[model samples]
Target chain A: MNDLAFRLRDARATLSAVAVFVALFALYTLNHPAGFSANVVQTAANKGVLLAFVAVGQTFVVLTAGIDLSVGAVFILANCLASVVVTGSPGAVALGVAAVLGTGLACGLANGALVVYGRLQPIVATIASGAIYFGLALALRPEPGGDVDSTLADAVTGQLAFGVPASAVVLLAVMLLVWVPFRRSLIGRAVYAVGSAEASAYLSGLPIRRARLLAYASAGLFSAMGGLMLAFFTYSGEASASNASTYTLDSIAAIVIGGVSLFGGAGSAVGAVFGALIFRTINDLLFVFDLDPLWQPLFLGLVLLGAVSLGSARLLRLKNRLELFGS
Target chain B: MTVPTTPVAPAPASPPMSAPARRRFDPAVATAFGCIVALLLLGSLYSTRFLSPDYLLQQLQVGSFLALVATGLMVVVLLGQIDLSVPWIVTVGGMMATAAAGHGPLGAALAIPFGVLCGVAFGLFNGLGVAYLRVPSMIFTLGVDAVAQGLMVLKTGGSAPQDMATPLMRDLATGRALGPVPNAVWVWLLVGTATSFLLSRTTYGRAVYAVGNREAAAYLSGVRTRRVTLAAFALSGGLSALSGALLAGYSGKAYQGMGDGYLLPAIAAVVLGGTSILGGRGTYLGTTAGVILITLLQSILSVVQMPDAGRQVIYGAVILAMLLLYGRGAKIGA
Candidate 1:
């Protein structure tokens, strides 16, 4: 019974965010009058799929108390490479997928190399690396215009059985895969230990370096996947696609909103996925309201700020309870 | 090179080396400096134009603004915070100064001050959130950056400044004084010198360093950590604005994204100059070298006709190698 309660309490962050999503959707429905339309649902599903994927990538890195600023840049680089290498042939699409995944892996390796052996702080190292990657992407295409396989895009992103978005299925699959290890795997628990206390983790003989390197690598790969899906949605190769650069922050906000600790050692992948969904709903609601695009960033930042402080406040209250109870 | 200082708990009792030996070479500083030198040397060898003093001086002049802004970043880094708002602030400041020059010389004066104050106000806002409000500087500065960037875009209407107001401004950028030394070079020298002196000699400087090294300790020592932090952000904002104003005078105009180019380089210079990103240790000298090195490399590459992306790849790789070599030095300095 106690274990059940603990598990239930652990899930509160996801539940709360979902509740917010429902409330916001309600408000939007009242205002739009034509709400619950299939198109709106499909758009939300598509947006949520892309955002959820990116947030999942961020989850691993943030779990280890580091960040990957280069994710957006890497996302762009993968697309650029794909646009250059991919073509009309089925083999070309296959190669394109391999090439993009390879690009992501290589970029992650570069970041991991610097961060691990170079003893570089993840944020600074990734920022510089991001600039270089972005520079390369710009140099490669400079301007935006390249075609991805429409068939491939449609197949992956189009509706599934019962008219559910295919991309939504992919996102759900990722969440399922993540949840298993996150609960039972020692490596996953090691990540939490490392984030909560680095030196302690090291002293305990964990492969802190390997874990960190792999975490960033996973982040890179997942971010690339996100970019692939994003490209499918846009259907055009844009070297300047990541120029908006808010995608990185947006992913992070999604994670935080879902109840992940910024200081690390807490949270779930599913929580992050749910966070992205709520955020997507809020953003869609804003569009329904005809609010300025600029307001999205401001609103996202404010919500993230509130979510984080609230999360911290809850932790503090728990700490107080533990102190009083002498747990 | 591990000092074996308590990483927050008891360690195996082992005296690794003499305390002085542990003290001399901070790995991070050494690595960053090594990267700078290696890049400088490689740049010099790769391009025939690098041998020419005339070619070299041109890069130095162009590099001054980056160095100036970086020196301010160095101070902030000492406090273990990052400021990403410099680019737009510089661009806006330059734009304001250029536009105000039409108001006459007096207007130029007003505009320049206004630019600095604009940055200062933003910095104070940053200080308020990061210091008093206990917010993460990253989120606060980035948010501030977005707000500033939006205002700049709104102000410029996504176009370049139509009127730069004077030939004097361009002359300031291009004119040479004593033996081919550019005016911008002189400006860089003064800023570097003054900053170095202020950081090294003054009580405030020491206090800043102390606060950065250990805020709790500094406060326990009654060093008014809040004021020092506020001042650090203020200085960062002010210097960024000053650099922007000068660039405006040099470029004879300001574009919407003019300061964008300088942002990364400014941080790069500070980091390469041996300033620990985690803060508490830095010097104007390292920042000076950093600016010079980046300028030299970029100029040499331009002469060699290497694409910017290629240069960047080499640059990133080089910086990484250097960090690997000297990261230990950085932690000690931190």
Candidate 2:
């Protein structure tokens, strides 16, 4: 019973996030003009999955108590790169994907090096690196035109069996292949330890540097994946400042809503995926309710504020004021 | 096995500093000033016009906008908190001021103050969340920024706002009230002086540094840390709004995303000025140097006619290099 209780507690944030997404999604479908159609689900899934990928990436860094502000920039850079190279024959597309992913890894490793080795603060370091990444994206696509391999794009973005989104399936596959194994690994445990209490973790002889490096590298890889998906979805790439900043902010929001502590050392990528879905659903909810498009930012903002405020409510329960400063 | 308890010995005291009489000059501030001079020289190589007093004064005028924004950011940074709501608060200030101006002459006269007050209100909201609710200032301010963005969008209906800057605002922002010196530059100097005085001379300023250094310790010492945080954020918001209002005046109109370009640059200037990102350790002199360095660099980049991409790359690279030079020694944690 104790074990079960501990497990439940561990999963509480993720579960609540899942519940919120379900409730919001139900409202969305119920109010949709077309009503719960595969097309509607597929479109929503496609959009949500893009943010989900970035959020998952953000989760890795956030789990280590650091943030990857460059994730969105890397995502956009990958989009630009993929649009240029993820075309032509199958082998060419494969090579292009590898190159894009490699770039993401390089970017992540750079951030890791700056924070871990160079001893720079994560926030300022990432801000500077994010600028560099966005610059590269701008250089790659001076204009807003490029093409992706249509066949691959269609296959990835299209609906699959039983009206399931291919993008959703891909997301599940990533969670299973990437997040699950990582979660069960030694380094992953170290990542959690480091976030929970870095000094103690270091004193305990954990691989602090390696764990942080891997976390940041994985963030880069996942952001790259998101960028690739974006290329497929849009069939082109643009070095859009608005899109880059929006995704970065939204990814942070999704992670927060997903119950991942900004203080780090808690939560799962699964929660972040749900959080991303919930965020995407807010837009759809507005659409279905016939609200002005201009109201979207306000609605999204309110939801974010509510979610964040709800999370911080636990602060009121602390008996000692000193405990307020603990985390 | 019985464990024997031993009494802990007092820690040995170290010797007193031999250099207690050393001057208070900060090398970081010196280095920043050095960079600013180097930038001016480099720009002169591209165009002799850069060395001309007219051009240099003009750059300072243009830089005052950013300087004002960074002044606010420095206060918040000193408090060991950040306000991501700066961008939207800035926009809200500009838009609201212009919107107010549309009412009449009285409304026009009150526009700038109205805009700044709106920003103060948003800052208070951010402070409440961070101080009382204990939400991370980063995410809390970001949420507030979104709300501000949404409100602006709803008001403007996703288009350019119709209101124009009041004549007085235009006069203050773009006018050369005292010879070649822009009135905006004078305004910035005034704010800067007040800030310098606040950070160095006031008891509240000392408390801000104390709270930033260690909140629990500050609290134990009877410092009203929460109120300090609140006041710092409010000041940051007001200044950011003031900068935005000036920007609107300079441009003769307010628009969506008008404040977008200032956030990163303002932050960069603050940090570049040798202000600690983690809070509690920096000088206003350093920030002033940082603001001047950034302005000169921008002018040089434009003089060379570098592409936007290259400019961004160089911009990021320079900030990173400077950070690597002085902003090292942080541990591997948020």
lDDT of 2 by residue, B119-152 (tens): 9999889889998898998899999999999999
Interface RMSD measured for model 2: 1.8
Candidate 1: pairs in clash: B26-B329, B27-B326, B27-B328, B27-B329, B28-B326, B28-B327, B28-B329, B28-B330, B78-B280
* Prediction-by-prediction clash tally: 9, 0
Report the number of backbone clashes for model 1: 9
Worst 10 contiguous positions by lDDT, candidate 1 chain A: A318-327
lDDT of each: 0.73, 0.90
Report clash pairs, candidate 2: none
List candidate 1 stretches off by more than 4 Å. Answer: A8-14, A25-34, A85-92, A135-143, A241-244, A274-286, A292-327, B1-47, B99-106, B157-172, B176-179, B328-334
lDDT tens digits by residue: candidate 2, A1-327: 699999999999999999999999999999888899999999999999999999999999999999888898999999999989998989999999899999999999999999889888888888889999999999999999899999999999999988999999999999999989999999999999989999999988999999999999998999999999999999999999989988998999999999899989999999999999999998889988998888999998998998899867788688999887664
* Cα error, candidate 2, residue B178 (Å): 1.4
